[model samples]
Target: MATHPTFITCSSVSFSWPDGTEVLDDFRLAVGPGRTGLIGLNGSGKSTLLKLFAGELTPAEGTIRTVGEVGYLPQNLVLDTALRVDEVLGIAATRAALHAIEAGDVAEEHFAAVGDDWDVEERARATLDQLGLGHIGLDRTIGEVSGGESVLLRLAALLLARPDILLLDEPTNNLDLHARARLYDAVDAWSGVLVVVSHDRQLLERVDQIADLREGEVTWYGGTYSAYEEALAAEQEAAERMVRVAEADVQRQKRELSDAQMKLARRKRYGQKSFENKVVPKIVANNRRAAAQVSAGKHRALHTERLAEARERLDLAEEAVRDDDEIRIELPRTLVHPGREVLRLSGLELQYGARVAGEFELRGPERVALVGRNGAGKSTLLRTIAGELEPVAGTVETHVPLRFLPQRLDVLDDELSVVENVARFAPEATANTVRARLARFLFKGARADRPTGTLSGGERFRATLAALLLAEPAPQLLMLDEPTNNLDMASVRKLTAALEAYEGALIVASHDVPFLESLGITRWLLLDGELRATSPEEVGSAVR
Candidate 1:
């Protein structure tokens, strides 16, 4: 494979949180001018590394160097809602100056501001149009657009700046299918040094290479995410084989050491017996015993050293194997009998002028995927069903105990421990019971005791999921809005596994088609202005 010239370098970089949690220590990475997908498990410092590259964060030690201008889009994009689209796009000043000049003001200052870029507004509009934001006028406020549009708007601003190095962190989090397609198109169009930290499988497939960040080190893999997976699978297979060989070597070394010790013991006994029986002269017997003792010592030392080396080799071999744990828990209480009435929506009129076309009913343990374009009221419908929001002019009737996990995951109390949070949802359950259940969610011992605010993205999701599934009365109706957003691929898979054990009526609002397909969704509903029946095959076109 051809290699691009290196444009960014981090030499012996070290960083830690205020809580003394070491994220990266003496980490070195060199990225060239190509699309590199930075991927890792949650809390592996993918975002932190991107921040360092964008100069949003300074390393505690070592140095970072970049060859050209850098632009960054953070995982959590916070922008002032009052700012105008042009201002957010960073062309407000130029547009203002151009307008002034066009009005015959002829001010030198206006001309200087314009600075040969007289078509700033045209360029801004072009960028927005490219990102599928043409309908969003440049004069509109950021608050007027959908959350997904705001993300694209930020990306548009970065593109307008024309930076040499572009660093994006989880850029497709809240995007719908159409918006995500636009973002993917933008990614495909990028030619400069592009390093994106994302869990979006489709987005990662477009990258030129994959940079797997694990244990404070970056391991580069040629080709896209699928190719990276293939390479990693092969690598792990070899590592496991080495581990088996090393295990055998360790066992053989232990057996040899034991055998040598037994032989030495027998030799000592024989020497003592011969000395006592006067088989040889006393002086000669004593000398022979000493010599035997020395020989036994040498043999014991040699065997012990070999065993130690073998154990060390085994440890190293074992370290090469990945330990990606899956969530495994059964929820018998959440199971609903066949033909059970789970949910009903009568003349459902949701907020923001969205409504269901007619009466809708869900029965038994139906798994439904609610998909739509941005600003299509999918979340509003889920919120209404979950009883967090009041319907404008209709009714949402859930027949069984229900729980909703929103996109923000605000169900958790940031100040409380995971155990406490779960207890909050299931107040009648004892601390021991809650902890035991939390352990099944991969929060064992001290992990269950850590505050929810201190957890990584994946850990927080698990903690929240544990609380919801273990809630009092058990939720037979579960609604999740964009549950897979901002989640790592592993977390997504773990979530799929966890949900597989759930025998409840599931309604997940997501743009992640692959994840939805994995859930055994029996029904697909597209929420545009009204809820309509869809299919896994029609989902791609229906949302667009």
Candidate 2:
């Protein structure tokens, strides 16, 4: 209810796609100063709304008012992969200077459009430095940096816009632990309004509020991420209760309607029998005129009786209710017994070029995490484990039937129907059996028939899990590579629950610190190629 400074406010605002299709149905949100986190499952219109807020897309109806400028960092924004890191920053500085000139605050020859204090190069370098992209050696090409680093560089440019508000879309995707920590720190220190669409719980923990986009509407929750989570849990429980109550009511009304219809049918039958046998024969035998009058009276009575029956049946049927789909879940069976030594690395090493893991060994269900600076081979280790890469090592052995959920959904056949995609994993399954199994994961009827390409990221992840589980027996060992990357809140919660109950061995490598903690993984291997193992407690002690 308070006025927002340096924030955007949407009032009865609506938008449609270029095809004149509706997206937001009079959607409303008050993004104010202080950090606010946006959370919704994929295709919930998070990105589209952010674009509208940034003025990239105009609302088709109502008004969007902004009190101040804004800075937006989009998700994994692709750079001119050909441009050098320095060149990109240099261009950004020039653009900012130009914007200042166009705003009539600076002379065309000087970026001091606002004041004599505007230092374009100094400010640009500072922003880039804060994001840890300064070490790219000025001349280093963007292509030379890893995919994650390039993303960060682009974010640095956006931040330098010096806007009064910030809208970040999935900012943590592909980020390493150090980089993510830096972003958290930056956001914590930010004075402007911040609205981010992210699935990372750790990032949200520091936020002042959380909001969700669902069913073409927005719902805001006060307090931190943890509070929002509690609120959502309570809401879900309430919704389920309402659904149950509705179902019970429907059943009760259905029974009443059925009984009433039967009674009406009997009444109509009685009227027919009374007219045919009791009244018609008497009319023929008695005085023709008197009998004819009696017959007409009986016919009139029958018509009135049938009309009453029809009204009663219609009223009863009107009270019955319709039904909806029920939610369910099923994980595959497991057949893996991890070796006494869950993972063994003997003279193990991974090299993308000049990197090496001298030698290391990990054992048991000890729950080890990989962490390091950017380009430090953290992902490479997981890649090697998932067999996405051939370890340039002595011997890396997984003594279990490992199921690897890759960071990306390359295993999915985009062209196939959702049911078919799951079916392919179980070539021996009948079409009906495959469909039935997939339906448990929320892909039912036409949804199952929809092409895999049509599924949102969360659905795609579920589809992948369903397919993998359909095997004769599930794999005992599970390997998740950046499992939380770009996942929705519901999917993240569902996955965290699944991982917690998983038996055998578990290996997860991710930048999601909160997720790892929630799942009880305390040991981490900092991968400066050494893969040294240390309990999170130990690291905490050392840092302290």
Query: Considering every candidate listed, which one attains the maximal TM-score?
Result: 1
lDDT of 1 by residue, 13-116 (tens): 99986556688999999998889999988767888898889887799999999888889998768789899999999989999999998889998999999998
lDDT digits (tens) for residues 1-544 of candidate 2: 2234566889999886553446687877777788988877665678778888888788889888877876677653667767876566645445456566767865655454334535655676777778876676555687677667877887776666566878888887878766777788888888888888887778889899888776677778998889997987887666666556655665556555555566655655655575666765655534554554565556555655655555555444443322223224455555334346656666666765424345454455556665555676666777777677886756677766677777655688988888888877788889898888888777878778767764555667777777877755566667777777766766677777766666556777766667778887847766554666666665433222
TM-score to native of every candidate shown: 0.92, 0.67
TM-score attained by model 2? 0.67
Root-mean-square deviation (CA) per prediction:
3.0, 8.0
lDDT against true structure, model 1: 0.87
CA lDDT of each candidate?
Answer: 0.87, 0.69
Error of 1 at 207 (Å): 1.9
Q: Which is the leading candidate under lDDT?
A: 1
State the lDDT at 298 in candidate 2: 65
lDDT of 2 at 331: 58
Q: Report clash pairs, candidate 2.
A: 105-113, 106-113, 333-474
